[model samples]
Target chain A: MTDHDHDHHHDHSELSELELRVRALETVLTEKGYVEPAALDAIIQAYETKIGPHNGAQVVAKAWTDPAFKKALLDDASKAVGTLGHVGRTGDHLVAVENTPQRHNMVVCTLCSCYPWEMLGLPPVWYKAAPYRTRAVKDPRGVLADFGISLPKETEIRVWDSTAETRFLVLPMRPAGTEGWSEQQLADLVTRDSMIGTGFPKTPGAPS
Target chain B: MNGVHDMGGMDGFGKVEPEPNEPVFHETWEGRVMAMTRAMGAAGAFNIDVSRFYRESLPPTVYMTSSYYKKWFLALQDSLIARGYINDAEVKQGHAAAPAKDLKRGPFKLDDVKRVMTRGSFARAAEAPAKFKPGDRVRAKNINPVTHTRLPRYVRGHVGTIERHHGVHVFPDTAAKDAGEHPTWLYTVVFDGAELWGPDADPTVKVSIDAFEPYLEPA
Candidate 1:
């Protein structure tokens, strides 16, 4: 590992040292019949488009519109989410926490990036960075402030640290004036960060 | 282990920088690494816990300096070599020193890639019934083993209440070491902010973690 670091510093070339190493590794593995390029492309395509935050948005939209679904979701997220065809990988046992008028919920993985990849796709870079891991638990309000979200002074914050297998999804409170809105319209208001409890749903007239 | 990866309550890392309109993969190499790692994993090269342990075992300097996928690449190389899929000489030379040996299950193919990415096997299995239930007072064990652990350092030795029972799941510590699944009861434990971060912490804040049965004791 140190040798690679030394090589990285001495080689001031167009390609980054990390990129060069990855390219070389891929070359050797592919040449030796250990990896298939087509297989690699297929995996990338699936994650890029076939699966992502849209699945979570659909779940959130259903919860907002159907009180029965909301009750079922808060009761057993893994089972309720499965009803929407969103069940697999890292989402095997999910728990849904609701954000009500009195309390707000946020999710963080302090040990490692254990997110609901099946629902929300790969976590954003900031979610895996050190600062968010440390500060999210120590100063959650301050962290929310950094994300430009400020709750009412009297509202309580509940930070969920994903330490084990069970993953968490925060059901953000529905925005006002969206009454009788279609599920499709409500799904548009639901953002990835809102489901993670970093921000709120978009207002009705607000630009996406 | 009390590795540097446990950054629950440490300081001096810096502010969280949210990049606007970030691409799924920042560079071509990152995408390649992600795909390769997942492919290798699908081939039964190693389990998720073992992969995480390899990343956690890196030196702090290397772990901190490398980007996210870069770390994945490093861990992949180390795991592949350790499991006899590749060797140091071949890795250094960037070519096959000899023809690859026959794999029992065969390498992953393009036709199955999508299915592999979408399906996942559950690690949970039936175990002894849960010792505690929701509203039960419990305390985290103060342990710092030099092995993979799901228990975070900040919550160790602190008292919390059992919020929910998540049922039995594979214990990561033993699984990372190639041991049996050792499934145990899991629960969501909620700690008062003041108990974990001192009285200075906001009294209204509460922190919850999903802890395995072995990491908790009746308070």
Candidate 2:
């Protein structure tokens, strides 16, 4: 009925632009004795921190120095990550994929962001997007190449689907010439990309 | 065996290339709803008695229309509403109505919740079943018209063998069930890409998917 209301409605029909619409609709529904808006708001907020993908570099660093610990990690990630103070939720049954000159590892969740949240933290935007999920499986080399992450032709990309129960971590190859580096130093060489099985683990003082 | 999020290299058809464009950037009420959900969990509101709601009442459309978190959220809301933490009418109420009300719940008496969260880590640790032996050849069942299944689309109807019987793991299908939410029989099956995709794959490129028992048949 009002010019202002007409302009506001015309300017935005999409949900992203008009979250107020959700609130408005919730009000109308609730006032008419139908819906409860606060519960919906609470639920959505809980997941916003779910920005997907966390740091992989740190996990790679710990693996380079610890063998027995690494064995435990590969055996069962939930408990193994406890060695580094990362546990619970996503780590229930952990598996560490290896990336070597002969084989490489990558991760994707085609349906949703089923990532190893505790170990890797939140997943990166690209890691959870549909493009990476579909393309990485189709042309693994092409997608990695675009990210400036190329392995030799002989290398194999072992893509993993991270699930809510079972989690994944990439065991990146240790960089050369770091004969005496500490675990922390080695951890620094690992990256989020390497953990996702895209980029190679960085060499200390070596170019990425 | 089958992890909920292990979807990898099937075919390159579903990618939303170049992404989308031309939308004003703002958080939706959906986001606001998600935010409040977290806060409620933080505030210790609601008596959320979660018991794996995936086995019975899993909505058919949820298979494709929802994200993992959305699945989880739906699962949470379903169980909650079913038990009366909030009703359908409550869900319809606008934001800010259900703020830290007098609804007192939660058994978290003295100690922190850190201990309870580890319940999954210690379930049947040694009591779990380990049936299939590794290195045994088996044929994956020819599951057709699979509207709701975790078995990868690429590996179905293909022949592979039990690579490793990684003990008894939780069955997501069952865990996701509304009535019975518990883990089921799980095993890892190693399928050579040549067997799955034929000449398109290198012979050495073998993919091993940890599959639940329902998806297998004896070779």
Candidate 3:
């Protein structure tokens, strides 16, 4: 592929519903033929990959209790994350973004939806589209608001747009008041958005 | 050509209207196609194992989002190139060798394909020396050199905080190099909006990024 094909540097704009409909129709028509088999097996194998939803939750739960581990996670993720046993594929060089009270982070692979699927599980359908890519950069506030997350004006918002070369995964801050929560209790606080840096991990016994 | 990221601002478009769910039509066709293709692969297709993995694990976003045929075609290309079955040049050649496919269902040929499928490019990368360490504050280089690079354009020249020190690994850019080059040191660089977008950026906005050793200098 040409270098431009995989680059995720440019600002993304929105796509109307009509384009999506047309895209769907085109996709359906293209599928009406005898397909190649290796491709099928490849798709199957990717899903069967060890980096699924379960692995991502464990990373969050571990971070909740172990401050030293969190420091390690921030210092050298690929090796540090290994302490929690999540590696391989996309995460060999994992980068974990922390969302604190004054700052929030969000990740989107604008070019090709290059996600940390292994650690975060499957991505939402909208993530692969162009609108989310363009609008996310141009109007971070608006996009976050749609997801019902509006950062305070005093707080800063940074969007990490992933490209073909690098992928991103979020490491949510340990919530307050859950000083002695179990692993399962911590896992419950992790949401898909938190892993992507859109929403904060719900604090234990906090609002839904 | 339109910029690759211009999916939005696609003209005076309206809201995404909902359509009736057509899961069956999708499943039956995509399933049949994938199965038949995999069977063809079993017959006399290209490298079977590598093909199998690439086909299955391609960017699911692309597979589901792009035109169905585009996804299949690209997936095939990625596998071919990845396994060195064909390079860009070979692909450009248009006429490549037939896979060492065993006669259909004669017997599974796992060993033969294994070598090609699992080839690693670790030997080609040039390992980083000195450079920087963890907690280093570096500004990403703004270089726009035209070579194979893993550094994204948006992140170039931005200032960031180095989060981790991932041990050197193979650099995918020089992967085609027949000789050796150890992988470079890679780290995360966080950038503030004012740093990337100036006045337009929010005062408090901060964006962190991954920076290869070459893409950074001491800030």
lDDT of 3 at A203: 67
In candidate 1, position A13 carries an lDDT of: 47
Deviation in Å, model 1, residue A148 alpha carbon = 0.7
Please tell me how candidate 3 rates in CAPRI terms: incorrect
On lDDT, the leading prediction is 1
Give me the runs in candidate 1 sitting further than 4 Å from their true place: A1-13, A85-91, B99-105, B119-123
Model 3 regions lying over 4 Å from their true place: A1-51, A80-91, A161-167, A175-180, A202-208, B1-72, B75-128, B132-148, B155-167, B176-182, B216-219
DockQ of each: 0.51, 0.23, 0.15
A71-91: candidate 2 lDDT, tens digit per residue? 776777666666665422443
Candidate 1 structure quality by residue, lDDT tens digits, A95-208: 888999999999999988988877788888889888899999988888898789899888999999998777888899999999999989999898889989998999999877
Error of 2 at A92 (Å): 2.0
> Where does candidate 3 chain A have its weakest 10-residue lDDT segment?
A1-10
* Alpha-carbon shift of residue A32 in model 3 (angstroms): 22
Tens digits of per-residue lDDT, candidate 2, B19-120, equal 222111122543543433333343344312232223114555553344433444455455545645455655555433443223233322223223322324
- Best-to-worst ranking by TM-score: 1, 2, 3
Error of 3 at A29 (Å): 22
Candidate number of the best TM-score = 1
Once fitted onto the true fold, the runs of candidate 2 whose alpha carbons sit more than 4 angstroms away are A1-18, A21-56, A85-90, A206-208, B1-92, B95-119, B122-129, B144-148, B202-204
Each model's fnat? 0.65, 0.21, 0.15
